[model samples]
Target chain A: MRGLEKLVTGRLEGVEHGSGVGMDALTQYRNSVKERLDSADVLVAKLVHENTVLSQTVETRTQEVENVRHQLKTLQNRVAELEGREARQEEEIEIVKDLFEHLCGVRVHKSYEDDTGLWFDASQGSRNGIMDYKLGFVKNESSAGTEVVYVPLLKQRSSDELRALQKQLPGYMFDTLSFPLKSLYQFYSKMARSLSKKIE
Target chain B: MRGLEKLVTGRLEGVEHGSGVGMDALTQYRNSVKERLDSADVLVAKLVHENTVLSQTVETRTQEVENVRHQLKTLQNRVAELEGREARQEEEIEIVKDLFEHLCGVRVHKSYEDDTGLWFDASQGSRNGIMDYKLGFVKNESSAGTEVVYVPLLKQRSSDELRALQKQLPGYMFDTLSFPLKSLYQFYSKMARSLSKKIE
Candidate 1:
């Protein structure tokens, strides 16, 4: 009976030890699973933060691009307007040159120099046919190798005709040759300004 | 004693009920935390996907802008080149016209409706030996305003000298003679072609 009692006690102790070991294993598994869940939560939170920052950065960049595009379009329009103005100016210059040619009995030569002026070649035609025409500089001096535009002016009476007129008119024939050249420039400027205004 | 034992049993049951309520509250809290974690994960994933798409779109838009800028620059350069070519062509045309005038002893007149080729008069000698060269175009087609352009083909000769030459060379002499007509046109065409080639 004694021996049987001793054996029973030893078996009970073994069972208790096995139960404790099983409980320890269960607690360790639970702790490992909880740690994995917490790590996953942290990773998702970091990703979310990073995504928010990237979205804001993209928004800022897009706005900058739009602003740049707007500026570029404005610049293009300005350049086009300037080119149109330049073309109009060139055409106006041609018309003015033509008008000068038609009005004066001298040839108008456009200088490529820093100054725009009129140059005359008085030594032309036959020896007996010496052309007498007055030429005045409009803007500047003449330069070598400059392209000169020659335009023959209107038909004016000869010196002999003028002398005949003077004899007939007598005292009324005073030399009104000396006129202020500045007035001519002012006249053309006024005409051009009026035309421009009309056209606008 | 039986009543006292019954009272103690009721108190123990109350303690067990309180423990059960606590366990239920813990379960509910754990479930709420799990739901929140799942929602956060979904939101993070969606944001990440959206950010990736936005980045790609921005890159594509930037490339398009660069391409447009390059094309605009190319177009501006082409326009400048065309303007330069036009200026050169105008210059070349003027040169050709001048050459023709020098060779033909004629001047081009841009009249309103009478754009026909005519003659220029070398008006010789006024009363004071002052003469002029006059240019006129055919206005009426009745030769009303037309004059004669005397070409200096030979050395200077007087009227008596020309009469003597006609008497000596009677076979070659003709009235209202117009020689070098075809050769003059051919020369003009050749010169024009050369000038055009230079511009090209």
Candidate 2:
């Protein structure tokens, strides 16, 4: 009886020991699962945050691109308008150059150094003397300040001829020749006619 | 001894039952963890794909914006060039218009209906009769085809005066007066001088 009691007690203790080991293993596994879940939560949170930032970045970039496109369109329109104006202005310039050459017998050359001017050198022979004229446009600061300058190369005759020419052509303001561009044809015609009469 | 054996057996059975319950809980927890991990993998893969596509979109958008900026810069340069040319052309036109008005002793009105033309009306009186002249530029497709048309208002003097004028101005090709824009001033000067002699 004593041996049988000892054997039964040993078996019971062994079973209890086995159960403790199994419970510990199960608890450890459960802890590992909980840890994995927590890590997944952290990863998901990090990924969501990163995605949100990326989305915001994309949105900003998209808006910037849109703005750039809009600006490009506006610039294109401006270029078109400028081109149209340029065409018309070019045609007008051609006509004006033609008239100057024919009426004054002067070849006008564009002044590269001057932004808003042209230059012509011509000799007008008269009974008294031959006068050399340097004609051009000079821009001033004011809106109507642009002047047509006629500088006689012959300094001696300049004063007398200029005075006479100014008197003969009463319509023109002689000292600086501050006349409108539209009336330039009339000024040149009078100059040509008066100069021709003197020469004849 | 019998009582001790029974007690040991009961303890062993209870331990076994508790271990089974613990193992079952562990399996359930592991399964839950596995499910969560699988879902997380799928979510991560989806997010990664979305991010990749979004990154590509952003890259493409960035490149497009850069292209637009380049275009805008190019267009701005074009506009500046056009503006410069326009300014020069405007100055030239102003000079030509002035010369035409002075030499012809007539006012030139811009013909809006004609894109490339101007018109003038004048009456010249002679001992024989009075003749009305309509002078203008007529654009032609070919270089030599463009002509300065002089239409007589009075049909009676048209035949005789046209012949006499043609004979008087031998330099001019009388039929069409097809002259270059540059030569227009010379042609008009000749016409005016001849007409003035005839009138005198």
Candidate 3:
């Protein structure tokens, strides 16, 4: 079929249209027609080839999309898990803190000095001088227990002032003997026990 | 050009080979050849259209892959951020808990009781009848403060046992007056002042 068109036709398409006598001219024309058919075949083959390549591309990209989607799903699950864990942890922290506060976390209104002591917290402003007494305590270790907490700051109070306070807050202890370590122990022991009452 | 093939060698590929004489046969052959060429043209057009569709599909799929990849990256970053936050929050919870422990979270080793009391914790196991003293206190509100906590059990001991304990732990107070309420206040006042120590 490739060169058949050139045979029948004299003037080349393969052998184009010729000015020959009757039969010869017809043959020449026929040959050229065959050539065109051959070319068309080739064109069709190329198009089919291109189609194959395009199909492959679509397949590959579709797979890639699926893989990425799977990855996204896994990440989403992880985020959900972490959010749950964080929320629970935060809540637990708050609960423990609450318990700690009740145990001995009570802070002095005006005398919030440190974790262990309260200086001049009870007495009114004796500012500029060491007039107020200090009250404080320490825990055995981690800090989830019962121990007296007290503090003070500036100036010494006269026996009169001490007696007055003792009279005012009868149940509240305001002893001044803690300066000497021995008295301090005695004061702590006393403080711890004073806050209790019969369950009945 | 299309009908040329059918002319000279007229056999009627489009019309069937005929035993006609000269010109008429050639004319008929040419016509059939033209028909074949037209069909070829139509086939090429169809192929081109199919190719275009394939190209469009490839482009769409490629874009989908890109979009999915972008989403995956964003999700990965979110996971990272959440992990960091959770880590920091967990660390903070631990620190606050440590501080609380040191403040007043101390538990009576043997006195291991509720959040607010240590009954026969200091006293030995009088675990049968009305014996050990009770000690407890409620927090002002949520529980993040300094308050005394105590508990107890049964079995009352004779006055002899009380006197013995008073001497053994000199600072530890042991009074049966709490039952009367008036003496209860006095006992508590006595108790709270005994646990403090001087900073010096």
Best by DockQ, which number? Answer: 3
- Number of colliding residue pairs in model 2: 6
Interface RMSD of each: 16.7, 13.4, 7.3
Q: How good is the docking of model 2, as DockQ?
A: 0.27
What is candidate 2's lDDT per residue for A1-200, written digit by digit as tens? 23322433343345335636465643444344344446555666677777887888889989998898898889889888988888776665555454344434544444333566755555543343344566676675676565666665546565776666554444433344556554554565566565545422
Reference contacts reproduced by model 3: 0.54
When 1 and 3 are scored with lDDT, the better candidate is 3
Count the clashes in each prediction.
Answer: 0, 6, 100
Task: Give the per-residue lDDT digits (tens) of candidate 3, residues B1-200.
Answer: 23433342355342233342344555555555555656666777788898898899888888888888888889899899989989987766554543333333232222224554323233221111112444443343554543443333325656765444444433334433223222333343333322221112
User: Is candidate 2 or 3 superior in DockQ?
Assistant: 3
List where candidate 3 sits over 4 angstroms from the true fold. A1-24, A106-200, B1-21, B106-200
- Rank ordering of all candidates by DockQ, starting from the highest: 3, 2, 1
Preferred candidate (lDDT higher): 1 or 2 = 2
Name the candidate that leads on lDDT.
Answer: 2
Candidates in descending lDDT order = 2, 3, 1
Give the CAPRI class of candidate 3. Answer: acceptable
* Candidate 2 lDDT (Cα, 0 to 1): 0.56
Could you tell me which residue pairs clash in candidate 2? Answer: A96-B96, A184-B98, A185-B98, A185-B99, A185-B102, A186-B102
The chain B TM-scores of all candidates, as shown, are 0.43, 0.50, 0.45
Give all candidates' CA lDDT scores.
0.39, 0.56, 0.48
In model 2, where do residues sit more than 4 Å from their true spots?
A: A1-28, A99-118, A121-200, B1-19, B22-32, B95-134, B139-200
